[model samples]
Target: MLNFLKKKAALIWAGNHVKKTQDFKLNAEIKQEEQLLMMVRTAEKTLFGRQHHFEDIHSIEDFQERVPVTDYEGLRAFIEKMKKGQRNILWTDTPLYFAKTSGTTSGSKYIPISKEGMPFQLAGAQSALFHYIAKKGNADFVNGKMIFLQGSPELEEVYGIKTGRLSGIVAHHIPSYLQKNRLPSWETNMIDDWEAKVNQIAVETEKENMTLISGIPPWLIMYFEKLIERNGKKITQLFPNLQLIVTGGVNYEPYREKMNELLGGKVDIIQTFPASEGFFAFQDDYLQEGLLLLTNHGIFYEFIPLEEYGKPNASRLTLKDVELHKDYALILTTNSGLWGYSIGDVVRFISKNPHRIMVSGRTKHYTSAFGEHVIAFEVEEALKSTVAELAAQITEFHLAPQVNPTEGLPYHEWFVEFEKEPEDLNLFSLKLDDEMRKRNTYYDDLITGNVLQPLKITRLSRNAFHEYAKAAGKLGGQNKIPRLANDRTIADILSEYKI
Candidate 1:
């Protein structure tokens, strides 16, 4: 009886959500303009606004002209002031919370989360689920237990404001309506050790009615492995009602085959694009190819053509100007007081009517050591194609430039952890190299011109990446290994574990 009641309520909510989404699609441009103006007006009196002439900003053009695009480092001074309990430094009021995330230059980055802007993050996640329910006409998953594998909810005070991992901070804000179905007791979630926590979670939820599981792809693989070990059965066999899997933090295509194998069959999956800055996009239509960009939400976006990025005269484009299939570096000016901030992500639009995008790679996370300029998207697509053709399965992989090789010319090096190694490893390497050259013309040119040799594959021992993460003190929630890097930081460390 309770299950039926929950399903009925979910369906009604989904119906209302669909109508609102339709309205957003029709007025996305206007809403985005309004969002920018409202945020400017709200923060006009703050220090940053006054410094940047926000009060004079009347249009997107004016705002863009007055404010220059910047990364976290540029705003570090104002954020430091806020951390010391300063008010109106960046926003109208002090931040309610600081969502901590790992940074490259700086050890830790604290992103302000305002009370008014935080709801949009939660709403974006709920919108994804509601869209699935509305389109699929199946709310049965809502009636069964749902698990969001996450970091500890325990938080520490940072000058009178709560601070923790984005996933941990979000855990505290789960809606009361879904609390009844949410799994892995609060006690279990608070465990600081990830492996220990997964063990406890497996013991507690294996026998329960788990219908929906949400997590990062790599970590979810760990949880699934634990569950499988406990019962010695496929995930679907253990939880016959399992219906949905929600994933984010990294691209899903690379891990899909292995995850499907673990589950014993394919299951409905929703991909989300979330960061401490904001919940940016999510897969709203299961049939659609890309994530639906949330235009009416708290964020106002700007795009810089990937080729033009870092150039002084680079064009910053608004929604009306974005072209389909062109890669652009994503910028955000949000209700949380972030203005013209480069969040380091690169996205390519797939649909324009109600804008949809695929995260191609990060602005900084690509290899260009030999002027080949190989991005994560190219390598992932190449690997996916090669894997399909060769009937091989991968557990994890990383790529770096082998600039100073012992014998041959400088080449790209791929360290791969294979779940099912191809019968002919040499053939697999050649095929992968051929596929990569097809995707990246510069890489092909380099090889043809004798500037570089074909990429070399270094097969890794099982659980190599897990050990790398563990040694680096990043063995848990939301921490992902970079797919491509110009430096040898990771590649050199991985060398010690080579098979």
Candidate 2:
């Protein structure tokens, strides 16, 4: 009876919350303008703001003209000052926490999470759930166990502020009302060894009514594998109530087939676009294929044409300027004091009615050897289509260019671990090549012009990715295998595990 009342109350609250958010979605342009102005006004006296003449900025053009677009390297100096307990280096106040993440360009990046900005991050996540609840008209999941596979909550103090992975920092902010339903135990969560932690998590939650499982898709797959191995039963057979999955960090389409098989049934999924930078977007409607862009969240957004990314005169565009299906590099000026920061992601607007977007790829994570410029989405789409046609399942895959081959022309090398290998591996490779050519005109031209040969697939041993990640000291907790690489660095390392 108590659970029933709680669920009923939750449903009511969700309905109201969704309605409120709809208003903002409808007025996204105005909301964004307001948000930008508010942030500028609040941080006008800060060192970064003063340097950029934020007080003189009265319009989007003024702000854009004053602040130059930049990446992590551009903000490193300011971040260093903040790490040393300096106040107002970037924002009006010092940061409450620093979310630590491994960087591709640098060794480590510490992103500030200010007290003023943290609530929006939490709100965005909560709103995703509430939207799901309102749309599905179900809150039964709230009454059952929920697991968020994450980093250790134990934090180190950098100066006076807490410092840890974004997931770990978020652990401290889970609402008290739902605390009892969250898992695994504190001791299990604190375990640094990912394999050991996953084993403990599988044991701890196997008997519970797990309804919502949330994490990056790869690590969640690992946890699912652990559960099935230990119990010799499919995930749903053990939990029975498992219904919803919330995932981010990487695209989910490539892993969907395997995830469904592990679940033993079709389940609802909410794909989110979250980073240590901020929770940018989330799948608000299960029927939709794109995430609703959060214009009213404590951040102002800008987009630059992907093709013009590094050019000196690259156009900085607001929401009104974006076109459908056009790729843009995502940029931000946030309440956390990230000014005109390039988050390194490429996205496409699928809908403008409520501003829905699909994360296409990354600015830096692509294979451009031989000038073909193969992107993450193009390769993933190729693999997805081929898998569907061949009725095969992929455990994991990575793409890298082979600049020189011992016996043949250079080609794209695919490292794939298949759960269900096709009867004819050669045919599967040909089909994948065909799909790739259909998607990327540059790649097709290269193959036809004899600059590159058809792609080659190298089968990998089971758990090859696990071995690679372990060797790199990034085995779990938001770590993901790079989907595409320009050079052979990842390819040569993965070569050692080839079957």
Candidate 3:
């Protein structure tokens, strides 16, 4: 009865507020600068704020002129100071914790999550759930347990600031009552070894009333596969009430067909775009075309055209200035005291009315070798189409440019670790190359110009990715395998595992 009442109340709250949330986001262009000004005022006394003279920042123009765009590297000095007992540094209050962003361009990064920032995170989460409930017109999802498949919450302290994966931090911070329907209790969630944790989760959740599952695609697949192995049936058979699946952190195109096959067409999926820097967007539309950006959610956004990034005095456009279908590097000046921080993600706007975006790729994770630039989305679409045509299953793959002068011709080499081998290797390679040409005109032109050879694919034995990640200390939760590389470093490393 209590669970039913809670769920009923939640349904009412979600129904009541979802429209207001959407209305606020629709007016983001009008409110962005005002919100940014308020943020500046709130953080004026912090170390970074005082260093950059936030008092003089009366308008967006003033704020932009005084503060420069930065990534983790640019803020490392201040971060080190904060780690070494500096009070009220980057954030107004000393951060309660830091989220360790894995798979860094340089190295691992620990982003400060202050008390002031917690509300943004929590609110984003609540809104995501509410949006899901409202969009699906169902509040019964909360009546049953939802397995988040989160990272371990055994936080490590760095100079009194607790540090761990973002999912772990969120799990640790969610209210006690909310944990009633959440899977893997604190004792289970604190297991540092991922395999052990997954095994425990598989056993524990097998009999629970699981209606929804959420995690990165790969980990979710692993969990489902484990359940299959343990129960001798599909996951939907085990959890007859399973209705929805939520995914983030990585693209779902490659895994969609296989996951659906595993579930026997028993569930719907909602895609999300979340990061340790902040919760950004989620899919609400029934068609799942693009993510609805959380524009009114305490974070002021800026977009630098991909063509203009790192150039001399590039124009940073706000929500009012951005247009549809152009690739832009994401920049943010959040309420959490991130002043014009570059988030290292590139996105393409799909809609301007309510502001929707699709994450294109990482800023540094693109291939322009031989002047044939290609983004992750194009590559992903190509692979998705090719896999569908060939009826082969792919577990994991990475792309890199092989550009050695002595190698006769430069080519984009794919390191594919397949679940099921293609019938014809040469034909499969041709299909991949053709897909790339079909999606990217520049790549097609380069091929026609004879500046590059055909795309290359080096097939790998099953589970090569797991072995590789294990060797590199990145096998566990929240550690993503780098998908694209400018150089052949990842390619050369994967060469040893070739089938």
Candidate 4:
């Protein structure tokens, strides 16, 4: 009953806060500056009081200028310090939990998400719910149980102290009511029995009335494909009450159309931007094109110009100072003891009044082969267009940069799986290449020999990629098949195609 009341109270508190923020109005610039000041004050209280890194930061400018920008590496060092029971460089007490993230770009980062950080994560989830509510203008459709396709928490012993990743930590914090019976009952140790977990989800979801689903896009896509194959129309026929689908952890644009089709074109979709470090943003309204910054949360924000790299003479902008349409890389100082940390995500301003922004992509998640720069968003858009034109069902896909040594041309190799094989694979590849060029002029010039030839597409056997990810111990729940690769490592992994 206490747990129930806590959840109910939290829901009410979140609902009221969303209403207040949505209704509050101020000059976009003024509002941003105010939020920045609040964030700095909070950071000073939380981070400065706890660590030596910001002990010298006497002012906001002083904090920015003196404190060097940090990434996951710095955070890891901090965690090591905590393990020694020493005072953290930022936090006074030990972190409540460490959020684990797959280190696709760099190495895996274990971010210290504090007890204060839980509110932001919860707010991010609430924002999606509020967006759904605001769109339908009613809560009538949310009656069915929601399923978060998350990693289970059963620990695997390496040295016997209990460690997995951020997913395990987050899973532990889930409202008990949500987990008492609603969560997938598969074993939690992901590395131990991924196949058992996947089989469990397949069997359990088949029996329940799952209305809302959340997870990384690639895994969800594969799960739905598996469901369709197993009990044809079971998704559409069984889950008549399913209404909303929330996804994050990777780009959704590539699989948006395909996902829409799988859901029978009746569900409302909302995208979120969350990381082990922080719960950044969520789509606040169905009509709103981008996510709204969680200003009242325990996170402070700063931005570096996208064009500037390698420590250029760029001034970081607070939320109030950010301009619309300008691309910027994010630097955050959160309550979780990270001070002026660069989370490595890039975002563009969509609005200022309520501080709405779109997650453009990641700094390292880009391809610059042949000098034609292509980020995840652009690639996602191109894939969406290709899916529409081909009228094809994409089971899974990955884009890798390939440089031809003989021709000295750099291009992209697309590894894709479709529901039905195309009659002319070469023609389909050409059409996809043409569409990508059309979407970005930089790609067009590259294809015309200024940089490289057109991209090459390789069709994989049905469910082949899924099987490979499963084999690699990456299948089940939230683990997704990588969608974009900037190097040949992923390409090499997928190259060994044996049916």
Could you give the C-alpha RMSD of every candidate to the true structure, in order shown? 0.9, 1.0, 1.9, 4.1
Give lDDT: candidate 4, residue 390.
71
* Pairs with backbone N, CA or C atoms under 3 Å apart (clashes), candidate 4: 32-320, 51-89, 99-166, 100-166
Error of 1 at 393 (Å): 0.6
Compared with the true structure, all predictions reach lDDT values of 0.92, 0.92, 0.84, 0.68
Q: Write the per-residue lDDT of candidate 3 for residues 1-499, one digit (tens) a residue.
A: 9778977888889888787786666788888888898888888888898999989999888988999988888888888888887886777766788888764565778788877776777777677778888777777777788888888887899988898888888887777776888887778888877778889999889989998898988889888888999988887888888988988888888888779877866687888888888888888673567988887777899999988898879899998889899999999987666778999889989998888899988788888876676888888889998888998888899999888746678888899988877898789999999999998889999889988889989898887888888788776676787788787777788999998
Residue range 243-330, candidate 2, lDDT tens digits: 8999999999999999999999768999999888899999999877999999888889999999899999899999989999988999
Clashing pairs in 3: none
The candidates, ranked best first by lDDT, are 1, 2, 3, 4
Best by lDDT: 1
Report the lDDT tens digits of candidate 1 across residue range 1-499: 9879989899999999889788787778888999999999999999999999988999998998999999999999999999999999889789988999999787799999999888988998999999999999989998889999998899999899999998888888899988988999999999999999999999989999999999999999999999998899999999999999999999999999999999997679999998899999999888766999999888999999998899997999988999998899999998888999999999999988888999999999999998777888899999999999999999999999999999979999999999999999999999999999999899999999999998899989999999999999889988999999998999999998899
TM-score of each: 0.99, 0.99, 0.95, 0.85
Each prediction's number of clashing residue pairs: 0, 0, 0, 4
- Tens-place lDDT per residue, model 4, 1-499, is 6645554554565566566765433444444445545545555544444344334555567667766677767667666666454443456456666555677655655566666776677767766676566555555434456666666676443222234565565666676656654546535334356555555677768767787777877777666766776678846676787777788877677677677777775777788887777788888776547887776666667889876743766778776677898778898877777776888788888888778888777777667765666766677777777667777667677888887545656668888877655677787788788878886778887777556777888767776787788777777645666566668776777777622
Evaluation by lDDT, superior candidate among 2 and 4: 2
Better of 1 and 3 by lDDT: 1
Backbone clashes in model 2, listed as residue pairs: none
